[model samples]
Target: MRETKEINALLHLIDDPDEEVFSTVSERIVSYGKGIIPNLENLWENTPDETTQERIELLIHSLHYRDLKTNLSDWGKLENPELLQGALLIDRYQYPEVSFNGITQELERMRRNIWLELNNYLTPLEQVNIINGILYNYYKLKGTEVAYTNPDEFFLHKVIESKKGNAISTGILYAALCQLLDINVLPVNIPRQFILGYFDPNYDVLHAGGNPAHKIQFFLDPMTGQVFTHKDVETYFKRISVPPIPTYYKPLTPKRTIQLLTEELSKCFGSQPYKQAELAQLSQLLGD
Candidate 1:
């Protein structure tokens, strides 16, 4: 009770005209972590000063970003990082108020829909077709043509809520769902583009002396669920005047996928000063 009273008193002191006094108070409140967010939000709602409101907003963002840093560091320590969990951590960076359970349930519903249409007899292409039909045609999820225009398109929760996403977010969702269905879909690290590759599980060991491209069944564009061939990838390289490399056809780990997303997002955050450091921290944690 005494600590609560002390925190409340410090919050009220935020309106003080002296810069040093307010800075001291702000630093003290920030030490309380995300648990103090509700109290800060309530103070912001009740307060009328624009200057004070702005300070409160910055405080809230700092708290959320701090929590994200801690969580992401711990996630990186896992020997096998789960795809959806990493994506959700990225989501929380933007939407601290989002319901984790709600997003999980929503993903579960999508997985069940795909599960209903799948069977052991189905070919890999047929399996992908079912996911395509369900997500794009039935669920009406669409690709954001001007995706870089908005940063929200990169976040998984926002993508789910808006039914719109950029390449990385959509690719992550596709990969996550395929993992749940026991399909060996992986992210293809093609330069200047993000795509998914369906691969044979034993290709790594079986084809150790063979070409990695031989293991790739097909490439799927998560944006439109359009299937393309290796020839198409080569054509893409030719169109861009770049030589194709074997690594481009290889599967990316969950950590690498998130790293790519953050790298792409960093390009868009040129003007946003606050996100720059947080992204740098995340990128370093992911070994970028």
Candidate 2:
């Protein structure tokens, strides 16, 4: 591979101002991961490229092989992709992003800085309380979970088809944030719902959920951020459009939630008013 200095020399040679060096670097930087980050940063600095800077940031993120607290400056060489993926598996849970040997490693890079923000936040709380806090906060800041399906089958299908707002994408972002906080959250598939998550506590009686209705409430030990089965929804999913469905606020088992996301995702591809193939894929994931 070419060294950063050599690449730096080449980057300056792009005669056409309109030519996108960012796109060039996007594809090229993967192999170089950590090594190319400084040059990419330099590229960002020299060029009038707010957008390119973002892309380079993603490149650097995709290439990262360390935890949130670890600085790149202290790093050594990254050996292979497998090791890289193993480093970023986000604890025990696996998703479409973690599907293979070589591909898994490359995909880990795609996760970018998803878990970067989560390092120091989590504490010895029950798992469910943490779930409620995250969902509640996120919903308050960004309304409606940025849902793909609006209960209108036709419109929902169009959004999914257009690759617009999606549950999986949104869920991933949500999960990444939780992970970064050192929050051990897992995606739980709830029936008829696209996806819910869980952060298991010490006792089996201890569980929590993310409700689609109401305040995204479920259960939590407010003090420790731990989740418990018996909790309230009026406090969760605070900025939700609908009123709290107290009847809906209940403990969700991981197995049950998986089934739920799969079924709802299947509807995406089903011949409803808003049929989508993406739903089929998501459904299959849950079933698997």
Candidate 3:
């Protein structure tokens, strides 16, 4: 079992009841005793919805294919839910492939271009300060609604708008670029709330976030068009009894990243199997 923080996070989402969560979990969860499977099965039997049933079945199939000691590599580059069948499906964020296509590419291109240009214009510090420039550009172009554009929304909407470049794509770009630029980053898919990011030299690990990275989270407030304060984020974290902390980077394996994304997809789409599997594979890549 990997003890990395991201691994811990990915494990947390197996129970997320979201499509993206399940999809992401599927790709990760490389280590286990099959304990989660039984729980998943029980949930499957109790789930009354057809989509849920489909998702539960597919997850069972995905689970059967692995066990402890499965070495994962090369899950590879993902296309949007547009080019493939998989996406973030079953979470509170519920994005379907049909919704994420157009947005993913645009965000990717934008991030890539920005990073490509930034090799000259700014240092990592300035880029961090001006980071909102990317966020504003993303939401403005997507016209992301306040209701669904939280952190998880980025995961779902990226797939929901599959080809058009949405938040998930934005995050993907953010993570990839940050890594390329030697910045520490992590994604928090807590619920229908803002997405939080962590970065600082003291807590940053070049490759993996161990137990030491002190992370702070900030999310955009669509209504105010500004970032939320600690007080604002604390209210939501309290719902889960998770007090706000400055150092919160949870290092996870590349596989876990995919699992988290898929788990969210499953929840969003009510766990439709074919789409769930498709999205899980597409979003499976997890590295710089």
Candidate 4:
């Protein structure tokens, strides 16, 4: 990071016209990792050529992306990784410099508001109602249909900042809140949909061997905070001609949920080949 002779030489060769020379220099620059970003930024500020500036920008992005891959790999290794933390890592893919402390604080505020209304006597449905009332009604968080045209809809920070997100982002937020409150709500592997299931608290202890679907009292659509009964899910399976398998009803682990999020987010980058490849790699890292 200190402007040593080697770093100065690399910075000077950034304008090399030969592709092989530039690629070698770029690799060496990236080898310095994220700590060299400030030096690159200063170089970008003084550089006159737009092409050279673009090259510097790519180098900076490469550094951030390399760091993201390492962090995500570490996150995947966590036995019980926090869902919010996983989602924030994905958010950082697009916004490398953004601070997520504000996002965490905002979530804490929402959690405290819901906690104030919660009591031991409230039914599971009632608890969900309070969450829905506060999040959807009071906080006015909105959910939109998943559309690949807008990449921001896939980011958690953007979702909180704008109060709008697609099904996946909103579902992550919904499940995250449930996690903070120690509720049993979780995302299920429902085909072609992102939905949460409220598990019976005693099911794990009492009937772990039985069909997992029997453990769910109801399903929730994160898009609108609307509840769905078993009958509704059954009808949906019939309409779609997909058998209602027990596995689909089981809760996805936090790591798997983040993997699915990365997979879905990758779709948004189809037009950008390099970006799509990078996202695909990120998703694969989570899977590994």
Top TM-score model: 4
Clashes of each: 0, 27, 84, 0
TM-score of 1: 0.91
**Would you list the rank order by lDDT, best first?**
4, 1, 3, 2
Error in Å for residue 67 of model 3: 19
Query: Comparing candidate 3 with candidate 4, which one achieves the higher TM-score?
Result: 4
| Residue lDDT tens for model 3, 116-196 | 546455644456555556545543434343332234554534433432333344444455445544555544444444243
**Alpha-carbon local distance difference test for all models:** 0.85, 0.38, 0.46, 0.92
lDDT of 4 by residue, 195-224 (tens): 999998765522367688998999999989
lDDT by residue (1-288, candidate 1, tens digit) is 234779879888988899999889889888988888888888899999999999999889988888888988898889888888999998787788878899889999999999999989988899999999999998899985534568899889888998999888999999999888778888887888888999885555224655667889999998999999988989999999988878777778888888878877766677886687778778888893
Arranged by TM-score, best first? 4, 1, 3, 2
- List the pairs of residues colliding in candidate 1: none
Candidate of highest lDDT: 4
Of models 2 and 4, which has the larger lDDT? 4
Candidate 2: regions farther than 4 A off: 1-164, 176-182, 186-232, 235-251, 270-288
Error of 4 at 68 (Å): 0.8
